[model samples]
Target: MNYSVKNILLATSFQHKISVSIFYPENSSNKSIIISSATGVLQKYYSRFASHFSSLGFTVYTFDYYGIGASNSKSIKHITANLNAWAFDQAAVIKYAKETNPEHKIILITHSIGGQLMGLNAEIKLVDSIITIASQTGYWKYFKGFSRFRMFMFWYVLIPFTTPIFGYFPAKKLGLFENIPKQVAYQWRQWGIHPNYMFGHFKNTELYFSTVSCPVLILSFPRDLFASKASVDWLASKLTHAKVDRRHLIPADLNIKDVQHFGYFKKEYQDSLWKLTETWINENS
Candidate 1:
């Protein structure tokens, strides 16, 4: 099957324009998928994954959150946004997908923080199912050993010290994936410091998590230090009404070297790890 990609700008209710790319399959299915990116990761990073789904007849939508990637209309320092703000952007994307393809069942594929932000969207009902990849609470205690110590330094030392001087988090400068808005960096730090992560920092947000009743497929890799099994469980436990399916991907069992937090979306895993996502979506849909 053939597929075509079109890049367009989507407007959020907050007056920010998000950069979105829609992949349309030549043979369209009755389903449409929205790929929500992890924090500081660009939408382009998921192009291979989206294209694969598009080739399989699922119309896929991938977008960059405000203040990141093509959506960055101004300097990072001037772009003020936090997790909740990004949630509104995600909600808008969901609304767009539903409105544009009324006949299609909506599927949400979230990576890392993308899954947590889904809880903040009031338009949760728009989604028919969800696939969370390494999405977990940011509470530092969820990790153990060196990973736990790393989280402490990330929250207390690196983020706090760098964000102020640069007016934003220069993740790329520090050899991280991408740069981040100052507020988003600060918000992440605050959540990491809290025992309950985002919910502990913002008490009312917990109600939103409970409202997601759609079937959810949670995928966590054993080697992903950032999203340990315990961390993933913390987030899953909050989905009080959702039918949650948890799967731990052990690289050794799959005859692979590694599939850490970000490796799941890498092109190399298209036949291995990605198959799990495709199978889950088909089963749930």
Candidate 2:
């Protein structure tokens, strides 16, 4: 295994310097993999998981979102949390990965929101296979009525009226709005009006899954807020691919605890996740 860390500039004016690690299995074929993080999480979060894939003989490229991880970017505003920005981040990282490893087939493995953005673009042939864990589908629209009133106060009134005079306003404990430019927060609030975190205006998570034509493996937990059992089944039905596999992991049969959202990537429980992931990759590729 050979490892190197470097920053790659993205066309979206985002800094996404990721740790590009390469591995060569004595008898393995050449393969390239890119792992993008969920929103606000850095690329390093997948260090262990990247190591797992690499051990299985993959040259892995993992990077953070615009505002998160090693890349430098304008301060993360509320708007950056939206799906559009996330999709941009994904496109940039994909381009970077292709440039770095032109000879290999590129596959994507992501967690949560990373899966959502993959759905938005409708560009599949570029990728060989995709694996998503605890990824969600559909709207958070349950908040629509309560959200409209808040948006009026924040964007139409607060940001427009207060920003120039106050220079900034407080956003949580992080001073996000005040410390960051008001424009960023304003955009964020505009998008936040929807319940869904990313791609709020889209039809549903299942609809997004339907648009995907490549081999996709979805792992979701019932305890997870987004990927309910029905949602997983809905996605499976829409996949259209006879080979796409969907699995739901619940907690111990003792019923003491439920499977966690992100913990599936951890070593303790990831044994099964890895086995299934590698099998899918090898079989499909």
Candidate 3:
């Protein structure tokens, strides 16, 4: 069950450098997993989860997007990287994982916005399977009650107002997540404002989603205020060519209070939720 972690800098096609960590298991399996972090979440947030998977014999890769975490080379204001740039960065990581372990089957594990990036990549076919945790379209209409109004303000009011003034989205200062490049914040705002999310924003999104043929398991929690069941289902339905299994988890059913937006990655869920994740990966692999 021993494993070692090594950090490396990955140069993307856009010339942006990504900070990546590869976990090597003492007894490696034929399956390798690349975990894509949610927006503003650091690669380090998944280190323990990646290590746990490595101990189970899977080589795991984790990385930060171009303007986030260890990949940030300069001030966020100076960074013009958008969603496409982040997707390209992820594509580079996938290519590196494929080249580094050519014999292994690659599984992509994504959180929130991380799951949405795969459809944007032409190299998604290289992934054998995908597991998306709370990944959903961010269109505010999908939410209900107070959550919808809050998200509406987030997209329409907060983002547009603050991004221009600060030259970046100061999410860290507001205690939301990490600070984000203004371009990313703007593009994300447009997507959230649209009814169909990214699919409505771009012309080629249907083709992008149709290209993915791998089996996908999408996990959503009822307690997650950010990703509603409707939003998750909207995303799941868009994966036209993939065999998608979307599960809506009720926290109380599992004898837990909640597994909100970021709780799934917490080490406390190792025995319950993590076990389910490992079993799914094995079955899908």
Instruction: Write one digit per residue (lDDT tens) for candidate 1, span 206-269.
Output: 4478888889999898868789999999999989999999888789899887888899888888
Cα RMSD, each candidate: 1.2, 6.3, 1.1
Candidate 2 lDDT over residue span 71-150, tens digit each = 43444443234345556667666665667667767788877667766765434446777777766543333213434344
What overall lDDT goes with each candidate model?
0.90, 0.57, 0.90
RMSD (Cα, Å) of model 3: 1.1
In candidate 2 the C-alpha lDDT for residue 256 amounts to 31
* Global local distance difference test of model 1: 0.90
Backbone clashes, candidate 1: 0
Clashes of each: 0, 4, 0
Better of 1 and 2 by lDDT: 1
Listed in order, each prediction's TM-score against the native is 0.97, 0.67, 0.97
Q: Which pairs clash inside model 1?
A: none
* Predicted structure 1, TM vs. truth: 0.97
